[model samples]
Target: MDLKDRKRTTRQRLFRSFCCAWAGLTLVVRHEQNMKFHLLAAAAAVICGFVFSIPLFHWMILVVIIGGMLALEVMNTAVERVVDMITEDYHPAAEKAKDIAAAAVLVYSAAAVVIGILIFYEPVMSRLFS
Candidate 1:
């Protein structure tokens, strides 16, 4: 192919990738209640940061926590879907794969919540007790 044609093909490929990603997100949102909850929690965290006037570093930490949890959730969903596709029948290994994926999301989410509490404790306590 000519250079111009190659460039056009590359652009088309990139666009298709983005479209697929968007479709995946839509599928997850439609089927995963946890994703909706996570998004709500993330919004709440951002609002809390604004309300308490958290510093840039704190905001960055929150961003990491929020992004990490959401990413993990998406990964967990992907793993579960793959496992399901492999076997509609019950299988121990498939169960284990799904369970492990879920556990990772749970573990990370729990840690994120604890860290958020720790970071916001003083500010929240003072605001409430003052």
Candidate 2:
């Protein structure tokens, strides 16, 4: 109601939001183990962007591909975990679901690889040749 109370409430809300975000990130990292690898790849892409002085557009594409792949992998991991939790024992439908989720990650990974090669190959090769 008062200015002081409003400021206090706003600070509390901001703290709560930060806590929630940290918790969510922890959950994703713990539950989706593959996230570590995706994160490593993203880090590598970022490093490459800086090292090569890639064009803005090229860097944008790299960021998008890396982000998209990581996002898809996270979703796939979540789906697989839920499905496994529902049915611990092997089942035909469960296998199909898990396989499909894995395939999605694989597809995204392949695309990311292609994009990486396209963006960096020339710069890399010229460095090597020189």
Candidate 3:
């Protein structure tokens, strides 16, 4: 293929990949219990941010935290699915892999909670006291 044709093909492939990723994300949101909870929590955070009129820097931080959380959950689901596909029966290695993957999400989630509290505490308390 010529250079132009090759570029067009690459663009098509990139779009296809993105579509597939969106499909996977939709499936997770629709079917995964944890993903559902994360979506709810993210929505709540966004509403809080709007209500508090958080600053630009805080908005940036919230965006990063929310995106990181969703991405991490996707990754955790991917890991679990891969492990399940590899074995039908229980295996110690598979269990360890799943546990570690889940632990990563849990650890990041804990940090995100701390950061969220730090970001919102002053605003919340000020509003309450005022």
Candidate 4:
């Protein structure tokens, strides 16, 4: 291909990447209700990070835990949706599968909560106590 053609192809590729990113963002926005609580928690953590001037390591841990919990919640929601679609009526096996997926999200959420409390409680308590 000529140089001009190569440049055009590169521009097209970049445009496609940008479009894909926007689409993914749109999907996240559309599914906000499924993960609203986790998003709220993440927002709270970010605000607290700025308010407390948390160190990099603490922020890193918070980010990892929050990301994991959000990912798990999203996966759980997907699994539940698929299961429901496959079996519209109530069934023991479907219930068990849905319960398992929910439990995974709950476990990650609990872990994230504990990490948040540990990371923020000291700063919060000092502010309140002193």
Candidate 5:
């Protein structure tokens, strides 16, 4: 296949790029267990936000946190896949690469948990305890 296929218009190129990004997200959601967990957590947070009637500003903060966590997870998956492709053998650097990628996901997940608690704890407590 020649690299010079029919030239796409700007809109076509942008749509194709969006399709590729969506495909990547689908692949990660299908294959990555951690992504599933993050999404589930996000869903729960959104539910709690509605149930508690959290402020719009709080919702915005939640959105940012969710976005950051999901983006980090996708990047971590990409890094691990690239590292594994580069070397299948037991290389120290390969191990380090995977470990660091995992650590990034861990840190984000932990932060998201803390923020979720901060956002929901008071409302949940008042509803339950009061």
Candidate 6:
């Protein structure tokens, strides 16, 4: 292929990939309960950050934490779906895989909560006390 053709192909592929990724995200948002909860939590965090007028550094931290959490939840859903696809019947290995994936999200969620508290506690206290 000519250079022009190659560049066009690459751009097309990139656009297609982005479309697929967005579809996956919409699927999760529409069908996954956990993802819905994560979305709500993310929204709440962003709103609270604005309400508190959090610093740029804190905003960065919140962004990372929230993005990591949503990503992890999506991964967990993928894992669960793959496990179910592999076996319709109950299996210890499948159960373990699902549990481990879920545990990862759970651990990250706990950390996110702690980070949220750390970030918001001072601002909330100051607002109330002042």
The lowest-lDDT stretch of 10 consecutive residues in candidate 4 is 1-10
- Model 2 residue runs over 4 Å out of place are 1-22
* Structural RMSD, model 1: 3.7
lDDT of 2 by residue, 1-130 (tens): 3355455677786777788666866888776668888888899889988988899999889878977887787678778879989999999999999999999899889888988999999988888899
Global Cα RMSD, each model: 3.7, 5.6, 3.6, 5.7, 2.1, 3.8
- The collision pairs in model 2 are none
What are the runs in model 5 whose C-alpha is more than 4 Å off? 1-6
Q: What is the C-alpha local distance difference test score of candidate 3? A: 0.93
Give the higher-TM-score candidate: 4 or 6: 6
- Worst ten in a row by lDDT for model 6: 1-10
Reference-based TM-score of each model: 0.90, 0.79, 0.93, 0.77, 0.91, 0.93
Cα lDDT tens digits, model 4, 92-113, are 9999999999899888877788
Q: Any runs in candidate 4 off by more than 4 Å, and if so which?
A: 1-25
- Quantify all predictions' global Cα lDDT against the true fold: 0.90, 0.84, 0.93, 0.82, 0.89, 0.94
Could you tell which candidate, 1 or 5, scores higher by TM-score?
Answer: 5
Can you write out model 6's per-residue Cα lDDT over 8-110, one digit (the tens) per residue?
Answer: 6777867777887899899888999999999999999999999999999999999999999999998999999999999999999999999999999999999
lDDT of 5 by residue, 1-130 (tens): 1233237776777777788789999999999999998999889899889999988888998999999999999999999899989988899989998999999889888888898889888989989998
By summed lDDT, the worst window of 10 consecutive residues in model 1 runs over 1-10
lDDT of 3 at 81: 94
As a TM-score, model 6 comes out at: 0.93
